[model samples]
Target: MRIKQISVSGLFGIFDHVIPLNMDERITIIHGPNGFGKTAILRILNSFFNSQYSELRAIPFKHFCLGFDDNTSIEIIKNTDNSEEAEKNNIVFKFYQPYSEPVYFYLKPRKIRSDRGFPMMFLDYGIEERHTPIIRSLDIRTEETLFSEEAVEHFNNLSFPNLKSQEEPNWLEQLQSNIHIRLIESQRLLNFVPNRSSRRSAETPSILSTVSAYSDELAKLMQDKFKEYGTISQSLDRTFPVRVVKQQPSTDLTDEQLRHQLNELEATRSRLIEVGLLDKDEDAEFQIQPQDIDESTKNALSVYVQDVEKKLSVFAEIASKIDLLRKIINNKFAYSYKEINFSKEKGFVVTTSYGSSLSNSKTLLPTDLSSGEQHELVLLYELLFKVQPNSLVLIDEPELSLHVGWQVQFLKDLQDITQLADLNILMATHSPDIIQDRWDLTVELKGPHK
Candidate 1:
C-alpha cells in the first residue's frame, strides 16, 4: 500500500510536478526553490489521507494523484471555475484499479452556522494577526467573514463529526485505512493541548514539556516491562520444581553447554539492567563451576537457565529501542558536554559534565537543553516511539534549528532510524547539508519552462 508516485497538476495554477519515491532507499528528499509547492504537496498528501478535507479545498491545485505499489491509484480533481453556490461539490475523488471500474466520490464542504459567531476556543486563545502568515502560506479559505484564518486552520486539523459524511463508501474507507501518514511540520516545538479543566479550552506548551512527558511515558513503560518480568519469574519459579523433576536428562547435555547457557542468561540480565528494564542483582557475581554440577544438578540447572531466558525475553523489544535512543542521543550530546542515561523512576536523566568533580556535575531539566538539542530529541522520539511500523512520515523541514555538523549527520541518523522503525520518510528540506551527496534520492520540483 506504499505510495510509489505522486503527481500534481496546476499547483498554485503554475507548475505541474511528478515525484517518484525512492523505494530502494525508503528515504526521499524533496528539494526545490521557494514557492515551488514542496511543502504544499506534503500537506495535501497528509490532509487527504488524514481526512482533513479543508486543506484540500484551501490549496489551489487542479488535480492531485497518488499511485501505489499495488498498481492502484487515487486522483483528486477540483473545479474552481464554478460559482460560489456550486463550489461545495467541486472536489471529486477517483480511485482506479487494474480491472475494476474507477470509483468516484464527491466531497461536499461543511456548512458553518453564521449565527454561532466563532468557536470559543479560538477567542480564548486570542487569534492574533501573527497567524496571518501561516494562513496565507497554507492558503486557507473560508466564506464566513467572522471566522479567523487561525480558526479555520484549527478547525481543519481537528476531527469533527459534521465535517465528514456519514455515508462514506467502503473502498474509499479501506483505502484511507490502509495508508498511515504522519506530518511533522517545521514548527515542531510548540504543542497545542487541551486544558484538563475544560475540553473546549486549550493551551500551547513548548517542546520542553513534550520531552518531559515522553520521558515519563518511557519510564512507565519500563516499569510495566519490569512488572511483566516479575510476573513471569513468579510463574516460572512456581512450576520449576515440577518441571525439573519431570525432566529426563539427555546424553548430549554436557556441563560445558549448561555453563555456556547460564553465561548467556547472565549477559542478557546485565543488558536488561543496562537498559533500565531490570535492577542490579546483589548476587549477580555468583557463577556455577563445572565441578559443582553433577548429573542430578545438571537437570535442575538446565531448567533454571530456560526459565531465566524466558523471563528476560520480555525486555527484548523495549531494550533495543532504549539502547539505540541512548546511543544516538549520547553521540550527539557528547559534543555539548552532556550525557543521557535511563532510570526506571525518571524517563531521561540528562546530566552535564561542566564541573571539575562528579559531585559538582549538574542535572538539567528537559527544558534546559538548547532548541537544536530538543528538536533532535523530539524528532527521534516521535520516529522511534510514536509511529507504527511501515508508516510514511512526512517531515516539512528537518534541518530547522540544527547546526551544520548535525545537519550533515542527519541523513545517517535517519537511515539508522528507518531500519529500526521500519518506516518510509518523505522530507522537504532547503539545506544541502541534510542531503549531502545523496542527490540521487531527491526529487526536484521545477516551475513552468520559459
Candidate 2:
C-alpha cells in the first residue's frame, strides 16, 4: 500500500512534477528553488490521506495523483472553470486499478448564503486570509480579510451544511485506511493545544514542554513494562517447579549451551538496567560453576533461563528505541557539553559537564537546551515514540535549526531511524548538507522550462 510515485499538474498554475520514491532505500528527498511546490506536494499527500479536505481545496493544482506499489492510482481533479456553478463541484477524486473500473468521488461543497454578513467579532481571531467561495461571497464591513485559509475552512465546515451527505464510498475509505501519513512541519517548536478550561481559547506550548511530556510518557511506559515483567515472572515462578519436575533431559541440552543461555540472559538484564527499564540488581553477580550443576539442577536452570528470557522479551522493542535515541542524542549533545540519561522516574535527565572541576554538575531542565538541541530532541522523540510503524512520514525542512554538522549527519540518522522504526520518509530540504552526497535519494522539482 506504499505510494510509489507522486505527480502533480499545474501546481501554482506553472509547474508539473513527478517524484518517484526510493522504495528500496525507504527514503525520498524533494528539493527545489523556493515556491517550487516541494512543501505543497508533501501537504497535498498528507491532506488527501489524512482527510484534511480544506487543504486540498486551497492548494492550486489541476490534477494531483498518487501511484501505489499495487498498481493502483488515485487522481484528484479540480475543475478550473471560474463559474460559481462549476466551483460548487470543483474537486473530484478518482481511484483507478488495473483490470477494474475506476471509482469517482466528488468533494461535496459547503453551502453558505451569499447575503450572509461577515462576523466583525472574529476580526481579532488569528485566521489567514485565503477566502474560499463561501467566504468570498459574504458581505463584509471592512476591506481587510477576516480569516486565514485554514480558519475560513474551519468556519465554513462549522457554519454550513453540505449540499449532500459527506460520506465517502466504502472502497475509498478502505483504500485510505490502508496507507498512513504523518507530516512533521518545519515549525516544530510550538504546539497549539486547546485550553483545558475553555474549548474556544487555545494555549501555545513550546517544544521544551513537548520534550518534558515525552520524557514522562517514556517513564510511564517503562513502568508499565516493568509491571508486565513482574506479572510474567510471578506466573512463571508459580509453574517453574512443576515444569522442571516434568522436564526431560536430552543430549541436545549441553552444559555449554545452558551456560551460554544464562550468560546471555544476564547480559540482557544488564542492558535493560542500563536503559532504565529495570532497576540494577545488587546481588545479580552470581555465576554458575560447571561442576556444581547436576542433571536435575541443569533441568531447573534451563527452565529458569527460559522464563527469564520471556520476561526480558517484554523490554526488547522499547529498549532498542530508547538505546538508539540515547546514542543519537548524546553523540550530538556531547559537542555542547551536555549528556542525556533516562530513568523510570524521569523521562530525560540532562546534565551539563561544565562544573567537573568543582566536582558538581547542574541538572538542566529540558527547556534549558538550545533551539537546535530542542529541535533535534523533539524530532527524534516524535519519530521513535509518537509515529507508528510502517508509516510514511513527511518531514518539511528537517534541516531547520540544526547546525551544519548536525545537518550533515541528519540523513544518516534518518536512515538509521527508518530502519529501526520501519518507516518511509519523504522530506523536503533546502540544505545540501542534509543531503550530504546522497543526491541519489533526491527528486528535484523543476519548472516547466527548466
Candidate 3:
C-alpha cells in the first residue's frame, strides 16, 4: 500500500497543489521552506489514509484524490449537495456539519466493481472536543451518512494480496476487518512528532509510569488485557494509602458508566450535579463536605470512589509493560545487558552492567547516561520494539535532540532498520544534515500557492 500521489485544495493557507510521489525508495523525505505546508502534507495524508475527515468539517473542497500503487484512488469532494457527477465517482468521506453533538463518520459503502471506492477502518477517531458520542463498532447508517455493515464484511471477505516481506514503520495498528485497508497511520514516530504519548514516553523513566501515561493521553478507556495481568493488582489498597482523586464542583460522578448516566440528566436544580441516574449528587461529599452533606450523599461518593479506583488500576497495568530498558540494552543499544535491577529499598534505582568484558561492568541509573545515549535508547527502542512492519511512519522532525553528526547519521540508521523490517518513512525535516544526499527522495512543498 504505497501512496503514489495526492492533491489538495479549498483549505486555509494551501492553494492548489499536487504531490506526485516517487515511493521507489524505502525511505522518503519531504522538505520545504519554513511555511511551505510540509507538515500540512503529512497531516493531509495521515487523515486521508485513516478515513478521518474531522479536519475537513464545514470546509469546501474542489478536489482531493489519493493515488495508490494499484492505479486505484480514494477521492474526497466536500459539500457535494448530492451532486450526481460527484456521486458517479462516489464520495468515500464526509463530515457532520457545524461539528455539533453526535459527530459522524459518513462512509458511503457501496457494492461496485474495482477502482471505484476505498475501504476504511480507524483505530482512533479524534472526537474528544465533541464529548464523544459512543457509537457501535460496526457500520453507522444515517440518512446523510449511510453504509451497510454487510457490505463492509463482504469487502473484507474478499481475497487480499499477500503481504510483502519487507520492513516497515513500527506504528502499524492491527485492526480486524473484511476490507483490505492494511496500512497503518500514527502521529507518533520516535518522539519526533511530539504528540501527547511521545512526550509521556520520553519523560517517564519506569515502565509503569510510561504505560499509565500512554493510556491516559490516548484515553483508550475500555481495554481488558490488564485484567489478566496482576503486576498492578488490588493488593496496593493496603500497601498504599487511600488518596482521593481530585474533584471539581462541576464533576459529580466517578464511575464511567455513571458519567453517561449524568450526561442524560437534565442540567436543572431539580436537581443534579453528577454522573448517576439516581436522584442524588454522587460527589456530594467533595462538593458539600462533611458537615454540609447528608449521609446518603457521602455514601454515594464512597461507592463512586471505589469504582474509580478499579478503573484506574487499568492504567497501572498498561504502565507495567513500558519498561524496555532491559529490552533496549539487549537489542538496539551498543551496550549489552549483563544484568539490570530496580530496588525499592535502594530508593528505586536502575543499575545496569554493560561492556565487552564481564568484569568491565558499570552500574548507573538512567540519569547517569548521557543525553545522547538516553535519547538514542528511547527513540530507537520505540522504532524497533513499538512499531509494526508496513506502517506508514510520519516523523515531524527527526533532529530534535541530536548533534549535527548524529543528524547526519539519522537517515542511515533509519535506513538500516527499515531494510531489516519492511518499513516506509516520510519525515518533515528542517535540518540539512538529515536531507543531504537524499535529494532524489525529497519533495519540497512550495509555500502559499504551489
Candidate 4:
C-alpha cells in the first residue's frame, strides 16, 4: 500500500505535523537545509519495515501512525527494555482495516545478536557476493523434511496458528517471507561501496565491510596490467573461457535489448551459483506447487496470484546485476565498462569500450576509478540491484561529491531504476542541479518537518 501521508507527533523533534506523501510520482525529492530532520523521516520509515524502533524508544509518544492511501494504517505499540519481561519488547504491529477492526499479531523478537539465527540476508553491492543472513533459527520444512507427519504439524502450528485445516494457505507467512528489500540510502551507501574497503572505511563507521576485486590479491595484477593497457582484458582473461555481453545501455532500450539484459543476468546467476560463490542455490527450483484447494477458492485466488506473478516476472535471480550492467553502460565515465565477463579463476570482470567495441575496449580495476566515479557506481549499483517492487527507498544528499553533470543526470537515472522495478524514492538533497525542473514533486522541509 502506498503511504498517502505521514502523521507524526512526539517522535524525535517532529512535532505535530502531517506531511503528505507523493503517491502519484515515482520519485519524491525533499530539499531543505541541514538539520531539517530529513534523515529522521527516513529513519522512522525504515524502522517500521524493520522489527525494532530503538530510536523511537527515546521519545515517549502516545501515538504515531503511518496512514496509507487505502485508509489503513499501522500503529506502533512500543515496549521498552525496562519492562519486567525481557522478551516482552515484542512487535505489536497493529494493522487497521478501513471500517473494520484492527488485526493484531505478535512476532517475538529473538534474543542475542542479529546474526545468530538464519533469517533474511542483506545484499552487498561492491562487485562481490555477500550473504549476511539475519540470525534467527526458523522452523523451515523442506520437501525432504515434510515426509514426517510430526514435522508437518509443527510447521503448520508455527506458520498458521488459526488455520488447522489442510486446504488453507499460510497467507501471513507468505507475506512475511517475501518481504520487500529494505531502505537503501544512496547517501549512506558509503558503507557498501568499493571505497568502503579502503583504509578510510575502517576508520569510519561502516555498516557493511565492502569487499571488491581490488581488495583481494588481484589488485596487484590489475594494477600491473592496466598501468599501460587500462583495460580488463588481462584481469578477466586468466582462463580459456570468457562470456562477452555486447548490449550497451541506451536512452531507451528495445525489446531485443531487454531480452539481452535478462539473458545476461540469468547467465551470470547460473555461473555464479555454479562456481559455488552464490548462496541462492539452496532455494527451490521452479515447480507447480501442488495445493489442496476447493474450486471456489481456486477461482477466487487465480487472478491475484497471476497479478503477483506478472509483477515478479521483472525480477530475475540477478535483477540487481542487470541494473548494475545498465548503470555501467549508461554512465559514460562509469569505469567505461562496455561488456562484462566471468571466469571461474578470475570471477566477475569488466572490459571498457568507452562507446567502442569490446575488442578495442580498455580495462581498469574498481580501485583505478576516482572517488566520485566510485560513488556514482556504488550508489546506482546498490539502488537498482537491491531495490524490490513497491519498495520505498530513502536517499539523503544524492549530490554528495558528485559532478554538476552527474547531479543533473541523477534524476532521470533514478526514474529509470524506479520504472524498471516499480518502486518509490524519497530523496533529500540540497543541490539545485539534482532538482533541475522537477519542482512539482519537491517537499520543502523547514526544520521540525514544518
Candidate 5:
C-alpha cells in the first residue's frame, strides 16, 4: 500500500513535525551529507512498525536508567489511500503511542540494577535515580494511535494485537499473517523504490496465501488419505489367515513355529521323493535340515521371502508417487527473481541475467558472475522482476558499486519498477544523479534537527 504522509513526534533527535506528502510523487529521495538524520529516518520507519514503545525509548534512555536522569519517547503518523478508498471518499492510517493503550506490541528493556556492596539484581521495569518505578507514560491506545478498524485490526493481529480474550483464535498465528496494508502516503520515495522482498511487508497476501494455503490443504489431504489407507490395510491384515509380518522390536518368532514349518516342508519333499516327483537326487541333498534351523524354519523362510518382496514393491511404488507429487507442486510455484549460470569445469566462467529465459533455464546467484554483472543482475531483479505495487522500500545507498553512466538508466528502471509494483521508495544517497528527478520528496537531513 502507498503511504500518503508520515509525521514523527518526540522521537529521538526529531522534533515534533508533520511531513506532508504529494500523491503525484512516488519516489522520495533523502539527500544530504553524512551525519544528517538519514539513517535515523530508516530507523524510524522500522520502529513505526516493528519496535515496541519501551524498546524504542531504551537506547536513548540507557544513561538515564543508569542514574543520569533522562527520558525519551516516539510517536508516528502514517496516512494511506487507494483507488477503493478514493471511490469511497475515505482515508485510512495508523499512529503509535508508548504505553497504556492497546499497542500491537510491547517490549520492555532488561534493566540491571547494581547497588554498592549489594548483590546484583534486575529491575522489572525502568527505575528512577532514587530507584522508584518510572512507569512508562506512553499511551499506545487512543491518544497515540488511530487507524481504520479493519486496517488496524489486521495490523494488530500481525503485530502486538491483543490476547485479552482467550476465546478468539489469534488470527495472526492462525494464518501466519504478518503484513499491514496502507495506501500511498506520499509520492516522495516512489522513484527510489526498488523491487525487492525487503521493501515488502508481511501483509503481502499473494506471497503467503499461495504457498501456505496450499501447504495447509496438502497436509489435511495427506492426513485423510493416510487414515483411509491405514483403515483398509488394517482390515486386510485382520482378514488374512497366513499373513506374514516383518520382525518387530517387541515381537519375536517362536522356534516351535519354525520347527513345525520346517517339518512340513521336509514332509512335502519326502512325499515327493517317494512319489518320484523330484527331477534330481541332488535336490534331496538340499532338503530342509531342522537341526540347523533356529527360530525360522524352511516354511517361515519361504513366507518371509514372499512378504519382503511384496513390501519392497509397495514401498518403491509409494516412493515414486511421492517424488512425482512433490515435483508437480514445486513446478507450480517455484518462482525465482533472477537466474545465473556458471560453468565449474571451464575455469569459473559465469553468465547473469534477469527473467526465466525462453528456454526456461534455472536462475543463478549473482556472485557467480563478475562484479558489474552481479550488480546488474541485482538491478534486474529490483527493477523488472520483484517490486510490488503500493509497498514501501527504504534504501541506505543506491549508488554503491555501479558505474556513473548507469546511474540515470538505473534510476529510470527503478522508477519504472515502482510504477509496475505501485511502490513507494525512500532512498538515502550521496549521489546527485539519483536526486535530479525526485526533488520534491528529497528531505535534507539537517543534522540534530537544528
Candidate 6:
C-alpha cells in the first residue's frame, strides 16, 4: 500500500502540516535539518498507517500526538485510473473507544454526507487487527464468514495471545516467541561471585573487590568452559541418551580423571533411582502396573487427554514452523551462496571466505560473527521474506550496526532484489551513504547525522 497525503493539525511542534508523497519514485526522502521534526514525520506516517487502536496507545485522546495536541488525517490507497473517483473514496474507519468517553473515534476517507449515517463498507483501521475483515488471520476451517469468532477465540487462547486480531495467527505466535527469546537473551546476567579468599564472603565483597573477584572467577570459568559443564548437567537431568555403559575407574587415575569418574557414577545413581531401580530401603522397586479406568473417570480422562492432545498439537505446529524456517534459512544462506549456515545452537552462522565456520571453535555461537556479517544476514532474511509481488514492506532502522561501505553495497544489492520481487520498501534510516544517490527519497532524521 502507498500513502497519498498526510495532514496533522497539531503534532510535536508543528501547528499544521501537509505532505503529499510522490508515488512515481520508488523511494521518498524527507530531508529536514536537525530538530526539524524529521523523526516526527516517520512517527506520523507510522501512526497514519497503523490502527487507531495502536495510535491511542502511542498517543491517546486522538487530538494528542505524543507531545503535541493534534488531530491527524492520513489517506492511503492504490492509485486508481480515475482521480475524480478517488477523491470521493469510500474508505472509512469508525470504532468505539473505551479510553475516550461516550462515542467511537470516527474516520472516513471522504467527509460524510451526514454524521448520522456511517459507512459499513469502509475498512476499520483500528489498532486491533481483528477490526478489519481483510487483515484478520486466515481460518481455513470456516468459509461461510470472513471473520471467524471461533478461530479468533482459539487464536486468542494460544500461548502467544494475539495483540491484534487482524494479524496473521502464525505471525503473532512467531512474534511472541521472538520477543520472549530476545528479552531472555538480551538480559546481561551479571553478578559478583566472591573470590575463594578467607576474608571474602559472598555477601560482603567491596565494589572494587567484587569486580576483581568476578573477573577472576569468570576467567577460570571461561578457561574451564563452564558452559560445557552446564550442558552436561542438563543432559543428565533430562535423561537424554537414556542409557550409557559405565567405564570402570582406572587404578592410575589422576585428580581430574577421579572427578569425572565420581560425576559419572553420581549421574548413573541418580538416573537409576529415577527409573525405579532403588527404594528408600535400598531395595529395587519394580514398575507399578497400570490401573483400570472407571466409566465416569474414563470419560473425564478422554476429555482431559483431548485437551492435552490439543495443547500438544499447538506446540507441534509451532515447532514445525520453526523447523521449516530454520531449514529454509539454512538452505538459502548455505556455504554455496551467502555462506551463512543456521543451527538452533548457533542461530545464523556466517562461514569464512575460506569456507570455515565463522567461529573458530565448534562450541562457540554463530552470533560470534562480525557485525558486518550479522547485518548482512539480517538484511538478506528481511528481503527474502517478501515473496509476493507489489507487497508493502515496512523496515524500521535499516542501518543497524553496519559499516558505511557495507551499507552502500547492501542498498545497491537490495535495489536489484526489490526489482525482482516487485516489493515496495518503506525503510527508515539515518544513513546518508546508503540513500545518498537516492537523495530525493531520503529523509534526514533529527539529531547529529552521525
Find the candidate with the highest lDDT and give its number: 1
In terms of TM-score, how similar is model 2 to the real structure?
Answer: 0.85
Candidate 5 lDDT by residue in tens digits, 1-450: 234555444334343333433447567776676655455555445433332222233222111100000111222222123465342322112122235342231222212222222221111122245543222111223222211232222222223333111122242232112322222211212122111222222221222312223223333443444354445445644643454444332235455665575575555444433322222352343355657654444444655433323322332322332333333223322332332221212211223334646565444322333344334434333332233445566666667655665555556666655665566676677888766665776766553444
Clash count for each candidate, listed in order shown: 0, 5, 15, 8, 39, 10
Residue 119 miss distance in model 2 (angstroms): 10
What lDDT score belongs to each candidate, Candidate 1 first? 0.80, 0.79, 0.44, 0.50, 0.38, 0.37
Model 4 Cα lDDT, one tens digit per residue, 338-444: 44433323533556664545567766555555566656666665565556678777786778778898888888888877776678887878899999998998888
Better of 3 and 5 by TM-score: 3
The reply for model 3, stretches above 4 Å from the true place, is 11-13, 58-62, 80-375, 448-450
- Rank by TM-score, highest first: 1, 2, 4, 3, 6, 5
Model with the higher TM-score, candidate 2 or 6: 2
User: Which residue pairs collide in model 2, if any?
Assistant: 127-148, 128-147, 128-148, 129-148, 215-347
121-171: candidate 2 lDDT, tens digit per residue:
332222223421222211245433433342355443222322112578888
lDDT tens digits, residue span 87-165, model 6: 3532223222235432222322322133223212111111233433221232233322223332233222121222233
Best by TM-score: 1
TM-score of each: 0.86, 0.85, 0.43, 0.51, 0.36, 0.37
Write the number of the candidate with greater TM-score, choosing between 2 and 3. Answer: 2
* Candidate 4 lDDT: 0.50
- When summed lDDT is taken over every stretch of 10 residues in candidate 4, the lowest stretch is 120-129
